[model samples]
Target: MHQTETSDDQNSRQAAKPPLRIIISRGSDASSFTVRPLMAALAAGTCMLVIGGYLAAAGYMMLREDNSDTSRLTQAAQTRFYEERIAKLRARVDEVTSRSLVAEQRYEKQIAALKKRQGEINARHSRVADVLARAAESGLTIAASDPLPVAKPRPALAFDATLAESTEATGGAMVPIDASVDMLGLRGSMGGVAKKADRRTPASPEKATISSEPTGASAGLRADSVIMSRIDSALDVMNRQSETALDLIAVAAERRIARIERVTSSLGLNLNVDGDGVGGPFVPLTSVSFDARLARAEKAVAKLSSLRDGVKSLPFGSPLEGAHDYSSTYGPRLDPFLRSPAMHTGLDFRAPIGTPVHATAAGTVVSAGRKGGYGLMVEIDHGDGVSTRFGHLSRIVATVGDRVDIGEVVGLVGNTGRSTGAHLHYETRLPSGTVDPELFLNAGEKLSGIL
Candidate 1:
C-alpha cells in the first residue's frame, strides 16, 4: 500500500507547486523587475463599478422624497391663503350692503316729504281758484303778468289775520283770524341742462385729452345753490302778495262801513247838531238851530254825545207811510168857518172820526184843552224851544206832562176845530213864531216832534 500511494501523491504535489516568481537581473548598473498588469487592471475596474452603482441608487432615492414633500407643502399654503382672502371679501361685501341700505332709506324719506308739500300746494291752489271765481262773479278781473323763474320750493310757513263779525247787537264783533301760507321758487337751470346735453359732441380716440370734469358732483352742487336762491325769491314774492291781499280786504271793509252808515242815516236813527253842520231828522229845526247863531253851543252838546257809535237818544221812526193823505197843507190858507182868507198855519189829514193821531217826535205833553178855534186841542213841547200842536181831536190818550215818542198814539182824529169835516190839524212852532210843519212830515225821515 505504501509503494502505490507514493507516486500519485508525489506527482499531485509537484503540479500544485509549479507557479513561481520571475526576476530579471542585469549588470551592476541595471535593475531587477517583476510585472502583473492584467491582475492590477481587473482589481481597479471592479472597484469603480461598485462605486458607480451605489451613487446612482442614492441620487434616485433623494430626488423622489424631495418631490413628495414639496408638493404637500405647496397644497397646504394655498389652502390657508384662500381662507384668509374669502374672509376679507365677505367683510367688504357686508359693509357695502349696509351703506346701500342706509342711502335707500334716506331717499325714501325725502320723497315722502316732497309729496306732502305737493299736497299742500294743491290745497292752496284750490283756495285761490275759489277766490278768483267769486271775483269773476262780482265783475272783477285778476291779472298776473310777471312770471319769475322757479328755483326751488321752500318749507311750509304760516301767518294770522283779524276780522270782524256782525252780532245781534248794533256793534260789530271783532275776531282773530288765523291763516297759513306756503312758498316755492321758480328755476331755469334744470331746463337749461337739456339744451347743454344736446350740444355735446362725440369723443375721438385720436385725441390725447382727459375729460376736464371727473363726475357730476360739482354740477349737482351748483344746481342746489341755484334752486335754493330761487326758492328764497319766490318766498319774498308770496309774502308781498299776502300783504297786498290783506290791504284789499281792509279797503273792502271800509267801503262796507260807509254803506252801513248811509243806511243808518236814512233810517233816522242818529242824533243831530244844529248850525255845527251836523243834524238828524230826530232834532226839530228849532232845537237844531235858531237862525244859525248858536253853533258853538250846539257843538258843545254834540261833544257830550257819542252818536258816532250809532247810539240815539230819541225814537225818530216815521209814524205813517204813503197812506197819509193831506186834507190841508201848512202855511196861511182860507179858514173854512169864516169862508174867507185867514191864517191857517197847519197841515190837515182827512180820515174817519176814530182814526188815530200819531206823535211825530219824542216830547212831553204841556197842555190838553180847548182853544179859540181848535177844540179838544193838545200841545206838546219838544226840547230846545220846539213845540207841536194837535187840533181837531175828539179824544186824547196822553195826559199833560206825559212823555211820548214818535209814532206813539196821541189822540183820535175828529171835526172838532171849526169843523167842516173829520180831519187832523198838525202844526210846529218856535218860541218866536209859527213855522212850516209839512217839511218834517216826510214818511222816509224821522218826525220833528210828537203831537
Candidate 2:
C-alpha cells in the first residue's frame, strides 16, 4: 500500500510537472513572440523618431533660412536708405563749406577795408599835427564865436555799410538802418580841430576848464583839433589865393617879357648888361607903369611872407637907370630965326643932331614921320588917353609900332623944316585937349627931386 501510494504520488507529480513545464514553455514562447514584435516596433519607432527629428530640424532650418532672407532684405533696404542719407549729408556739407568759405572771404575784405580807413585816419592826423606846429610858430591868435544858429543835435544819418550789408544778401534792395553816429558831436569835433589848426583860441572871456565838460578829453582835444583844422584850412585857402595871384602875375610877367623880347629883336638896338644885372640893357617903356604897380604888389608879397615864411618873393629889381627925364618944353614964343610970334606946339633942348631922344614914360610909338611945320616928329601913345609928340628932330630914331623904354632914345634934336634952331619939341596932350607942358615938366622934376 505505501509503495502504491508513493508511485501514484510520483506519477502525479511527474505528470503535473510536464503540464506545468508545457504551460511555462507556451508562456515563454508567447512572451518571446510578444517581445519580438515589441522590439521591432521600438526599432521602427526609433527610426521614425530620427527621421521626424531630421524633418523637424529641416523645417526649422527652412524657417531660419526664411528669417535670414527677410533679415538680409531688411539690412539691404537699411543700407540703401543710409547710403542715400549719407549722400544728402555730403551734399549739405559741401554747400555749407562753400558758404563758409565765401563768408571768410567777405570777412577778410571787410577787415582790409577797415585797415585802409584806419590808415587814412592816421594820415589825416599827421597832417593835423603839421598844421598845428605851424600855427604855434606865428604870434597870431584866432577867435571863436557862439555856436551856429542851427539845431542843437543834427539829424542822424543811417550807416551806409550796415544798410548795404543787410541788403547785400543775394538781393538788390534798399535796407533801412538805425545805427548812426553823433553827427553834431562829430561836426563840433571837426570844427574844433579846424579852429586849433588855424591857431584860433576861444573867444569867450572866461576859459572853460577841462572838468567843466563831461567829455573832457574829447571836448578839449576836439576843440583844439577844430582850431588846428580851421587854421590848416584857412592857410590852405590863403595859400591857394596867393598861388592864384602869383600865377596871374607870373603870366603877366611872361607876356611882358615876351613883348619886350619882340620889341628888342625888332629894333636895331644894342641890349647888354646894365646897373641891375645882365637881364636887359633897358626897361621897356610900357613896363615902367607896370613896374610901379609891381612895386605895390610887392608889398602884398611881403605881407604873405609875414603870415607864413614858406612863400618866396618874385624878382622885381630892373636894370634900367633912367625912368623919367625931360629935355625940352612947349610954348609959343619968338622964333630963333624968324624973330616973330609963332605957334610953337612943343619946346626944344640944345641937343646935338643925331643925339638920342629917350622916352619920358612907358608908351607905344604911334607915329614917326615928317610933320607940316616941325622936322621929323615922333608921337607916343601913353596909356590912359595921354599922348606925347616930339618934333624938330634931325632924324627919327624910333619907327611906328616901336616900343621904347624910359631911357631909350626915340629921336635926335635938330633944326630942320619950320625950326629956327636945333632942339627937341616935346608936347603932351590929354584926353580932353593939350595940357600945359610945364605941368609934366614939373612933375618929372618932382620925381627927379625925390630921387
Candidate 3:
C-alpha cells in the first residue's frame, strides 16, 4: 500500500511542471532571451520609424511647390512696372518735341517780317537821297539853327562763347538760339537820321512820335517798327514842304498875270476870262491836296509865260525908226493951221517930206488910202483891240490886208490934209479911246528886263 501511494504522488508532481520555451543567440557563450519577446519589441520599433519618414517626405514636397508659385508672381509684377514707366517717358518726349517745333515756326515768321520792313526802308532812303541831290544842284540853301549829332554805327551781335563752342562741336546741330541782340541801338541810329533830315527841312506840324519800347518776337522786328515810324514822319514833312513851294510859285505867277491884265484893260481885252461852256464829265471840285496844288501852280506858270509872249508882239515901241524932233505933244495944244487953242490928237514929229515911216510893231494893214481929213493914211490893226494910224501921209507903201513886221516901211511922212507943214502924225488908239503913244513907249522901256 505504501508503494502504491508513492507512485501516485510522483505522477501528480510530474503533471504540474511548466511547458518548453525556445531561445536564440548570435555567439556560443552569450546569454540569450526568449525569441518571442525579442520578436515582439522589434516589430513595434519598426512600425514607429516608418511613420516618421513618411511625414518628413510630405512636408518637403509642400515647401518646394510654394516657392515656385511665389517666384512666378514676382516676375509678372516686375514686367508690368517696366512697361508703364516706358509709356510715360515716351509721352513726355513727344510733348517737348511739339513745343520746340511751334517755337521754331514763330521765329521764322518774325524773321520774314523783319526782312520785308528792311526792304521798304531801303527804298524810301533812296528816294530821299535823290531829292537831296536835286536840291543841291538847284542851289537851294537849308538853314538849321541846331544841327543833329551824328550817331555811331551799331556793332554786330555777339553770341555766347559756350554756345558757339557747342555749336561747332556738334556741327551746328546743337546750337542754341539767342533772341537778344542790339536791335535797340540800330533803331537809335535810324532815329538820328530822321532828326538830321528834319533839321535840314523847314518846320512843319506833321511830326510823328517814335516809341523806344521793344516789340515782337525778335530784336530785328522791334528795330523795324522804329525805322518805319521815322520814315512816315519824313514823308509827312516832305508833303508839307512841297505844298509851300507850290504856293509860292503860284503867287509869283499871279503877280505876272495881274500886270499883263492891267495893260490889256485899256484896250478892251479881257484876259481874266474862264471857259464859256463846260464839256465832258463834270467832276465836283474837292479840296486840293499837295499833288493837285502843285499841278495847278504849274499850269498857271505856263499860262503866264504865254501871255508874256503875246505882250511882246504888241505895238508899244516908237513909231519912227530914225532920229526925229517932236513938234507937238499928244495932248491939247495950239494947232498951227487954226492958230487957236485946239486939241492935238496925235504926236507931231518933224521930218523931211517923203521920209520913210516904219511900223512900230507887228500888225496887218487895214486901210491904206485917202481919208476925209488926211490925204493919205496907213492904218495898222494890232492884236488885242489896238490900232495905229499914220495920218497926213505923203504916200502909202503898205496895201490893205498886208502883213507888216516891226520896223518895216509902211508910209511916207508929209504935210497932208489937216496939217500945216511937212511932219508925221502918229496916233495910238485903243478900243475905248485914243491914248498917248508916249505911255506905251514908257511901259515898254520899263518891262524890257522882265519880258
Best by TM-score: 3
Best by lDDT: 3
For candidate 3, write residues 344-364 as lDDT tens digits. Answer: 556666566777888877899
Residues 1-451 of candidate 2: C-alpha lDDT, one tens digit per residue = 9999999999898766522111235643643223344577788999999999999999999999999999999999999999999999999999878876776686567556556655654554454333323322321111234332332232232212322211111100111223233321211110111110011111212111111054854465466556555655654554343333333333333333333333323322222212123265775434444334344334332332242221101001111121212222233333334433333444344344555676666668899998766667888876656677777677887999987655567877566665544445666666676665555443333222111
Residue-pair clashes per candidate: 10, 28, 0
The candidate, 1 or 2, that scores higher on lDDT is 1
| lDDT values, one for every candidate | 0.48, 0.46, 0.57
Descending-lDDT candidate ranking: 3, 1, 2
Q: What is the lDDT of candidate 1?
A: 0.48
lDDT by residue for model 1 (31-106), tens: 5444355556676788888888788778878887898789878877887788888888888888867765765575
Off by over 4 Å in 1: 1-322, 443-451
| Model 3 misplaced stretches (Cα beyond 4 Å) | 1-249, 266-269, 275-289, 309-314, 321-325, 350-356, 372-375, 383-385, 393-395, 412-422, 431-433, 449-451
